[model samples]
Target: PGVTRDRRYGMVDWPGWRFRIVDTGGLDPSAHGILGAMRTQTLRAVEEADVLVLVVDAAEGLTGVDRDVVALLRRSGKPVVLAVNKVDSAQRESALAEVFALGFEDVFAVSAGHGRGMGELLDRVVELLGPTARATSDADADADSVDADSEQADPTGEKSEVVSSGAAADANEDPVTDLALDGEAGDDDDAADADDHADGDDADNDNGHVAGNATDVDTAAAEAAEIKRFRRPEGPIRIAFVGKPNVGKSSLVNRLLGEDRVLVHDMPGTTRDPIDTPFSVGGKDFVLVDTAGLRRRRSVDTLTEAVAGKMARDQLARCDVAVLVIDAAGGATVEDAKIAGMIEESGRGAILILNKKDKVPKSQINSKIDETKEVLSFLSWAPILLTSAVTGAGVAELPIAAARVFEQASRRISTGEVNRFLEGILADKPPPAGPNGRHVRLYFATQAQICPPTFVFSANHPTAVPVSYRRFLSNQIRQAYGFQGTPIRIVLREHRKKRKSAPPERN
Candidate 1:
């Protein structure tokens, strides 16, 4: 096997992330012992990694070999995250069980080929990895104090996890890690510890660390603090419509346009390059991208085909929401699930568009719908829209659905509204009791931020919020406010003000 240095690095132009991504070759013995060697190298990379991303073949469920790989990863003692690839159907949800069987509970079923599941996967990974903690050896801490001078200067002392990619122009430059991953980087216990260490450092300046370096650190910290405040202006929402060949994605696009804008062909994979067409949906301007069909790896024979497929997938990284078009008449296939999984993995909001429903029989259509629900069960919430490109059955509703999903994805609820909503919910049926007899009182709520709307609720005994109640609240939010086809996040925080209770005096 020929050896080549495939390592590349650079800054990702993400608003709140300094992404350092290492693209290593995968190891598949049958394909190439080169893959095996690559796996070894990749594993080493994983050790230095804040996150471990294992991309699986979605079409080929968790096979015996993939299981073996998972087993190996589990034993590695690293934070193992699974990405089930090529899942593009309503029937493929069952295949997820096979992946779960691999012992990775946190599995992301996605279609890398069609840009699915990429977003949430990254979000979770980043959350888990956190701002890359300085590889501070336990030895880095002196006695009871840690030299957290680096952190103190960091006003919002969130461990800066810089995600660098080898794919960029300048790899050596460490792009500034954003201040906070969460909405607000309040100084927590960890930050307090770092602050204490800083105080101790100032008290006993034995080494006399240079004033210039101190200023530089302070400046970097200041910059990091301000970085959190910097908000990139919002732009038009970019949507990518992707699926397997002859799935009516193009047809649907044409239907949406009410004109033959995209080249609609009877043949699969006719549209080689991803075509971008701008259109208005629910009064919101959107750029609809119609990518070439993404087929199975085995099905991809030619180099041109593979390249085109890659280009189609890369488009997912560029999109805010991805519409996965499935052939409803054909029934939800493993292919459709795989594609759905990809959209999910991309972390982009997804609306599973079941097109060509007019052709399918009633019984078959019902069965297909059930299967679609089953396969997409992993999704917290999303709409399965049945449409027909030939006949405008549900095409008009597609844009409205997309816009609604987008709105939900980017929505941030006001604190006042959340508190009022909480009051109403509690009055209807109070939260279950905690370990103590005291009932949990929700103090207030705030928009933690969006792209899958996240809400933070400050309450008494936040940890005691039952899973059932959380689900109930999630549903209520969706029903009252149109969360529609986007995922919603509900975070619980202990209200400090509620903790200090004093009798209210008559004023």
Candidate 2:
């Protein structure tokens, strides 16, 4: 019943309003262990959300847990929208009567699976959030009006001319509007023409006179462009904290965030869902995702744990960087190695965090790192940091290290630079001969892509090139370019010779 073990956030935009929705774990008053942690997350969501939607299962009817949840929400003094989910048909509408007794006013019978009665529920939510929604819409409209006015009042002071010409061009070029007019069979076209004429009349009344002159318009446009350029936000680098359960992934996240943003428990698998919290360090933005600790697939006993494991693995694909936390005190296990392999396969920038550093004796730190490295040998390129969430040792360096790794992954080398580096390296250690003792001639090298910098080499026999040679080239490239904390891909392509066409035969 407690599938959502953490707060999951999403944004929904309607015609005139936009709002955020938070889905929380099911509530249970008598819950302990993981369920108690879920209750904490849900209550936190209740504290933060503008409005709350309490979904109840119609088939199960009302229960003690539902009543407890209602009481909990009532205590928060926040508006609640009760949704009687799984109410599939009109016959189930009678079941909604039981829910109204627990609620203040608004309640709806909804079939979430079939998408029934959701609109009324959403409408009621929007109604409750009307004031904020109206403000947001008004702000957006004001911004749009400013942009339109800026476009219309250009350097030439031809505001009306620009507006009319642009409108005419749009009317002529828009196929969708034309199809709509055709569907109306000229009735709507007359009204549209009337509206255009009215707009043109209004433009004429303005006499094409704007307050700003050519110089002013140019200056304003430049200022606006500069402002927009400066204000444009860069997408935050998403970093997922993952490892075997109870390795202190959530603890590390909490340490880095300087708050308990994610739940940390002594019990394993405390965090079921990937919790994404936006954080900033030294002016750079990042989304720190604390994921469910992953165990071996066979070890995943419950369906919920299986789903959680899947979700954690899925998070690796979405993140730019992965912070693989291992228990430094316990040493890296085979499970940790498997998780590291997953990150490498996902092609994400990675950082190995040997957390619980405080527990490990300071004398054994280097040995622990070496042992972990031996187990996770595949991730040798990934930087490793020993951190302790409890003592806050090395926690501050996590984001900085992640940022550096991200930059390294996103680094691109020029073709000329690549070729030069290849020339120098090939001379130092030439490619091994093909199986038939034929020489493998290397033509040239170029960077094919970035964000996990990939290099392509053109050769006479691409397939004949050995994996050892590819590894050698990768190592050389990394050494030359300092692709630290990121994996570099090497590809080989055959340099095909051009075949001359024979003269056409005249018959």
| Best of the candidates, lDDT | 2
Alpha-carbon local distance difference test for all models: 0.59, 0.67
lDDT of 1 by residue, 151-252 (tens): 001011233322211111111211123224231235253233223223322121223211111222232233224322222235556778898888888788
Q: Once model 2 is optimally superposed onto the true structure by TM-score, how far is the C-alpha of residue 438 displaced, in angstroms?
A: 0.8
Clashes of 1: 52
lDDT of 1 at 311: 76
What tens-digit string does per-residue lDDT give for candidate 2 at 1-507?
445556565445556655555555667767788767766766666666667777777766777777777787777787777777778777777777887877468887877778888788777877877665443455454321212211111111111110000000011111001111111234453333223222221111112121111222222222222211111124778899999999999888888877666777898888887877777889997888888989998898898899889988999877889999999999989888888989988878999999888898889999999998899898899999988889998999999999999889877665445555765676667777888896776654555455667676666678999999899989888888888888888777655433358999999
TM-score of each: 0.47, 0.78
Q: Give the lowest summed-lDDT range of ten residues in model 2.
A: 160-169
User: Who wins the TM-score comparison?
Assistant: 2
Off by over 4 Å in 1: 1-235, 258-260, 264-267, 280-284, 295-310, 345-347, 362-367, 424-443, 459-469, 493-507
